[model samples]
Target: MTDTDNRRLLRQLFDAALAVAQPSQCLHHFLPPPVKGRTIVIGAGKASAAMAAALEAHWPDEDLSGLVVTRYGYAVPCKHIEIIEAAHPVPDEAGLVAAQRILSLVQGLTADDQVIMLISGGGSALLPLPADGVTLADKQAISHALLKSGATIKDINTVRRHLSAIKGGRLAAACYPAKVVNLLISDVPGDDPAAIASGPSLGDATTCKDALAIIDHFSIAVPPAAREGLASGRYESVKPDDKRLQNVTTHLVATPQRSLEAAANAARAHGVTPLILGDSIEGEAREVGKVMAGIARQVVTFQQPLPTPCVLLSGGETTVTVRGKGNGGRNVELLLAMAIDLAALPGVSALAADTDGVDGQSEIAGAIVTPDTLFRASRLGINALDYLSNNDGHGFFQALGDSVITGPTLTNVNDFRAILIR
Candidate 1:
C-alpha cells in the first residue's frame, strides 16, 4: 500500500476501535430495570456524560434525576441528569464539589430506590472527594506523584481509594437500602472493577494497607494526616463483604478487549490480517514500545510471528515516568520510542492514540509513524532522539504534522496501538 493508503487504513482501524466503545454502541444491553421508587443516576469519568445521555434514551419516560462529573469538554446534554464539567488526571475544586454533591444525592435513599452509576475511566481524579483528615490538595499531590512515578493503575488507585470519600465502594455503601447497579466502562488493564474508577459503586478488595504499600513503593509523599488515615485504617474502603454493599451489582458495559476486537474486524474487512497482541499489556511507555518494535521487526525481517500485509493490535494503559520537561502523553511517547527503534524499517507503519482523544494533558490523541519517519524528521532538522530524550513526543509529532486529533471522542478505553506491516 502507498503511504496515503497506509495512513488512511490505520486511521480507519483507530476510528473503528473508538466507535464500538461509545455508550450508544455498547451500553444498550446492560441497562437496568427501573426502580420501584426512583432512578438516581450518578457518575464520574470522561464518558460519564455520554453514558448519562445513553441512559436517558433507553428510559426517556422514566423519572431519572442525578448528577455526573466528566472532563470539561466531554459533557453531553442530558434531559434529567445534571452534567458537571471537571478536571481530569488531576483533582480540582470543581470535582471536589461534584463528589460531595453526588454523595449527598445518594444519602437517605430507601430500599425501593436504585442507583445507576455510569462509571468510566478518569473517574478517580474527576470525583476527588477527600476523606476526613485529607485535603483535596493532599490528594492532588499524591495523584501527581503517582502519575509521574510510572505506577500501575491499580497502585495509583489503591492510594486514591484510601484518600477519597467517594471511591473504593464507599459510594455504594452510602447508597445502602438502595440497590446499586454499576454500569462501568473499563479502562484499566484486566477490567478489574475495583480498578475502574476505584470501584466507587462496587466492593473493593484492596485495603488501606495496600494503599500504604504503594505510597512507600512509589516514594510518594503524603500529608501527615493522610498518612495517618492509611496507617490507622481510618480511611479504609468498603470491602467485598461489607454489609452495606451487599445489594450492589455490577455490569461491565465496554472494555479494551472488545474495542480491540472491533478494530481487528475492521482490519479484516480491509484485506489485512490482524493479530491482537494483548488487551491488558502494561509497563513503562518507552520500554513497551521498544518491545513492540522488536515484534514488528521480526514480522518484517523473518516473518516469524506473521507474514507481510498484517497488523498488530493491542490495548491497555501504559505509564509514563515523566522525568523530562515536555508533554509526555504515554501514547505519543510509545509511538516516538517505537519510531526510534524501528529506525524507519521498511514496510512498517503504525498509529498510537488514547481512544478518549486526549493524551496526558494535551488535546492531541496521539501520533503516527511510518517507514520514512526518520527521513522526514532529518529533512526537517528534527532529531527524533532529542525529542524523545525531553519527552516531547507530542511536539515532535505536531511539528511533522502527524499528530492525530479527534476533538473529544466522549468515551475512554485507555490506549490503542496498531502496527501495519506490508
Candidate 2:
C-alpha cells in the first residue's frame, strides 16, 4: 500500500479507538436505576460534561439534578445537571469554586438520596480543593512541580489526595448516609479506582506516610502548610475499609485496553495484521519511542515478528521530564524520537496521538512521522536531533506540516500509538 493509504489506515484505527471511549457508548452500562429520592450528580474530569449529557439522554425522566466540572471547552449543555468548565492539569479559581460548590451539593443528603459521581483521568486537577491549612497557591506550586518531575500519576495522586479536601474519599464521606455510585473512566495504567480521580468516592488505601514518601522520592518542594499537613497527621485522608464508603459503589465504564482492541479490529479491517504491544505500557516517552522503533526495524529487516503490511498498536500514558521549555507533549516527543531512530528506513511510518485530542498544553493531538521525516526536516533547515534534544517536538512536526490537530475530544483513554511497516 502507498504511504498515504497507510497513514489513512492509521487515522482510521485512531478514530475507532476513540469511538469506544465516547460517553454515549460507555456511560449507559454504568448508570444505576432511578432512585426514589433525588439523584444528585457530581463529578470532575475532562469527560464529566459529556458524561452528564449522556446521563441526561439515557434517563430523560429520571429527575436527576447536580453539577459536574470539565476542562475548558469540554462542556456540554445538560438540562438538569449544571456543567462547569475549568482548567485541566492545573487548578484555577474556577475549578476551586466549582469544587466547593460540589462539596456543598453532596452534603446533608439522607440515606434515601443517591449520588452518582462521574470520575475520570483529569478529575484530580479539575476538582482542586486544598486542605484547610493549605492555600490554592500552594496546591498550584506542588501541582506544577509534580507535572515537571516526571512522576507517575499514581505517585502524583498520592500527594494530591493528602493535600485536597475533596479527594481521598472525603467527597464520599461528605455524603455520609447517602448511597454513592462512582461511574469511572479509567485513564491510569493499573485502573486503580482509588487513583482514578483520586478516588473521591472510593476509599483511599494510601496514607499520609505514602504521600510524604512520594514527596521525598521526587524531592518536590512543598509549601509550609502542605509540609505541616503531611507531617502533622492532621490531614490524614479516608482509609480503605472506612465505613463511610460502605454505601459507595465504583464501576469502570471505559479503559485503555478496550480502546486498543478497537484499534486492532480497525487495522484488521484494513487488511493489515495488527499486533497489540499491550495497553498499559509505561515509562519515559522518548525511551518507549526508541523501543518501538527497534521493534519496527526488526519487522522490516528480519520479517520475523510478522511479514510486510503489518501494523503495531499500543496504548498507554508516557511521561516527559521537561528539561527544555518547548511546545510539545509526550506523544510528540515520542514521535520525534521514533522518527529519528527510524531515520531513512524504507516503508515505515507511524502516528502517536493522545486519544483526548489535546496533547500536553499544545493544541495538536500529536504527529505523524515517516522514514523521510528527518530528510524533509533537514531540507527545511530544521534539525530533528536538535529539536528532540530541546524538547521541541511540536515545533519540529509543525514545521514539517505533520502535526494532527483535533481540538478537545472530550473523552480520554490516554495515548494511542501505531507503527505501520510495509
Candidate 3:
C-alpha cells in the first residue's frame, strides 16, 4: 500500500485503541449498583476529570459529590464533581490543595456512605499530599529526581506511595467505615492495580525498604524530610488485609493489553497482519527500541516471526535514563533510537505514542519515524545519533515535522507502539 494509506491505517488503529479506553466508554462497566448511601466521588490522574464527567453524565440525578484532580489541560466540565487541575509527573501547589481537599472530603464518611475513586495513570503525582514532616517541595524534589533518574513507573510509584499521605491505600483508609470502590485505568507495565495511580485506593504491597532501594538504585537525591519520612516508619502506607481496608474494592476497568488488542483488530481490518509482542514489555527506552528494531529487521529480512506487510504492536511503559537536559519523552526517545538503528532500512515505518496523548512532559504525544528518518535528518544537517545521545528526540522529530501531537487524550494506558514492515 502507499505511505498515505499506511499512515491512515496506523492512525485508525491508534484511534480505535483510544476509543476503547475513553472514560465514557469504560466508566459504565465499573459502576457499582446504585448504593443507598451518599456517593462521594474522588480521583487523581490524567483521566480522572473525564471519568468524573462520565460519572456525572450517567448519574445525573444521583446524590453525587466529590473532587477529582487531573493534569492541567485534561480537565472536563462536570456539574457536581469538582475538577481540579494539577501538575503531573511532579507535584505542585495545585495538587497539594486538591489532595488536601479530597482527604478532607472523605474524613467524616460513615459506613452508610460510598466513595467512588477514579484512578488512572499520572495520579501518583496529581494526588500529592506528602506525609507529615515531608513538605510539598520535598515531594517535588524527589519526584523531579525520580523522573529524570530513569526509574521504572513501579519503582517511581513505590517511592511516591511511601512519600505521600494519600497514596498507597491511604486515601481509601481515610474513608474508614465507608465503602470505597476504585475504578482504575491502568498504565503500569504489569497492570498491577497497586501501581496504577500509586494505588491510592488499593493496598500497597511495596514497602519503605522498597522505596529506599529504588532511591539508591537510581541514585536519586532525597531531601532531609524525605529521608526522615522513609526512615521514620510512621509514614508507612496501608497494606492488603488491613482491617481498615475491608470495605475497599478496586477494579481495573481498562488496561494496556485491552488497548493493544483493539489496535491489533484495527490492523487486521486493514489487511495487515498484526503481531502482538505482548503488552507488558519494559526496560530502558532506547534499549527496548533497539530490540524492537531487531525484531522488525527479522520480519523484513528473514521473515522469522512473520512475513512482509505485517505490523508489530506492543503496549507498556518504558523508562528513560536522563543523561542530557534535552526535550524528550520515552516514546520519542524510543522512536529516535529505532530510527538510528534501522538506518534507512527499506519499507519500515513506526509510531510510538503514549496512549494518554502526552509523552513525558512534552506537548506532543510521541512521534512517527520512517525508514528514511535518519537519512532525512542527515540531509537536513541533523545528526540523528547526536540527538539520541542528547536525549533530544523531541527536538529531532520536531525538526522533521514528525512529532505526533494530540493535545490531551485524557486517558492513560501507558505507551502504544507499532512497527510496520513492508
Candidate 4:
C-alpha cells in the first residue's frame, strides 16, 4: 500500500478500537434496572462525563441527579447529572472539592437507593480527596513523583488508593447500605479492576502496607502526615471482604482486550492479517517501542509470527520515566523509540496512540512513522536522537507533521499500537 493508504488504514484501525469503548455504545447494555427509591450517579475519570451522559440517555426519566468529574476539556452535556471539569494524571483543587461533594452526596443513603459510578482511566487523579490526616498538596507532590518514577499504573494506584478518601472502594463504602454499581473502562495492564482509577467504587485487596512498600521501592518521600498515616495503618483502603461493600457490584463495560479485538477486525476488513501481541503488555514506553521494532523487523525479514502485508496490534498502558526536560508522552515516546531502532526500514510503518486521545502532558495522542521517517528528519535538521534523549517525542513528531491530535476521544481503553508491515 502507498504511504497515504497505510496512514489511513492505521488511523481507521485506531478509530475502530476507540469506537468499541465509547460509553454511548457500550454502557447501556450493563446499566441496572431503576432502583426502588433514588438512583444517584457519581464518577471521576477522563471518560466519566461521557459515561454519565450515556447513562442519562438510557435511563428512564426520573429523579436522576448526581455529579461526575472529568478531565478538563473532556466534559459532555448531561441534563440531569452535573459534570465537573478537573485536572488529570494529577489532582488539583477542583478535583478535591468535587470529591468532597461526592462523598457528602452519598451520605445518609438507605439500602433502597443505588449509586451508579462511571469509572474510567484517570479517575484516580480526578478525585484527590486526601485521607483524614493527609493533605492535597502532599497527594499532588507524590503524584508528580510517581509520574516521573517509572512506576507501573498498578503500583502508582496502589499508593494513591491508600492516600485518598474516595479511592480503593472507599467511595462505595461511603454509600454504606446503598447499592453501588461500578461500570469500569479498563486502561491499566491486566484490567485488574482494583487498579482501574484506583478502584474508587470497587473493593481492593491491597493494604496500607502495600502502599508503603511501593513508596519505599520508589524511594518516594511522603509528607510527614501521609507517612504517619501509612505507618499507622490509619489510611488503609477498604478490603474486598468489607461489609460496607457487600451491595457493591462491579462491571467491566470496556477493556483493552475488547478494543484490540475491534482493531484486529478492522485490519482484517482491510485485507491485512492482524496479529495481536497481547493487550496487557507493560514496561518503560521506550523499551516497549524497541521490542516492537524487533517484531516488525522479524515480520519483514523472517515469516515467523506472520507474513508481509500484516499489522501487529497491541494495547496496554506504558510508563515514562521522565529524566529529561522535554515534552513527551508514553505513546509518542514509544513511537519515537521505534523510529530510531527501525532506522526508516522499507515497507515498515507504525502508529501508537493513547486510546483516550491524550498520551501525556500534551494533547497529541501519538505519531505515525514511515519508512522515510529518518530521511525526512535529516532533511528538516531534526535530530531524532537528541529529541528522544530529552523525552521530546512531541517536538520531533510535530516538526514532521505526524502528531496524531484527536483532542479527548471521551473514552479510554489504554494504549493502541499498530505496526503495519508490507
**CA lDDT of every candidate:** 0.92, 0.88, 0.88, 0.92
Preferred candidate (TM-score higher): 1 or 3:
1
**Residue-by-residue lDDT tens digits, candidate 3, 13-94:** 8888899999999888778765777899999999998999888888847588899999999999998999999998778999
Runs in model 3 lying further than 4 Å from the true structure = none
Q: Taking the tens digit of each residue's C-alpha lDDT, what string does model 1 give over 200-228?
A: 88778888899999999989999888889
lDDT of 2 by residue, 225-294 (tens): 7888888887899987889888988888899889989988988887889999888788988999999999
TM-score of 2: 0.98
lDDT of 4 by residue, 1-114 (tens): 699999999999999999999999999999999878899999989999999999999997768999999999999999999999999877899999999999999999998999
Worst 10 residues of 4 by lDDT: 319-328
- lDDT, model 3, position 239: 95
In angstroms, give how far residue 406 of model 4 lies from its true place.
0.2
Q: How close to the true structure is residue 267 of candidate 3, measured as C-alpha lDDT?
A: 85
| Candidate 1: residue 249 Cα off by (Å) | 1.1
Residue-level error in angstroms, candidate 2, position 23: 0.5
TM-score of each prediction: 0.98, 0.98, 0.98, 0.98
* Number of backbone clashes in candidate 4: 0
Of candidates 4 and 2, the better by lDDT: 4
Model 4 residue runs over 4 Å out of place are none
RMSD of each: 1.0, 1.2, 1.1, 1.0
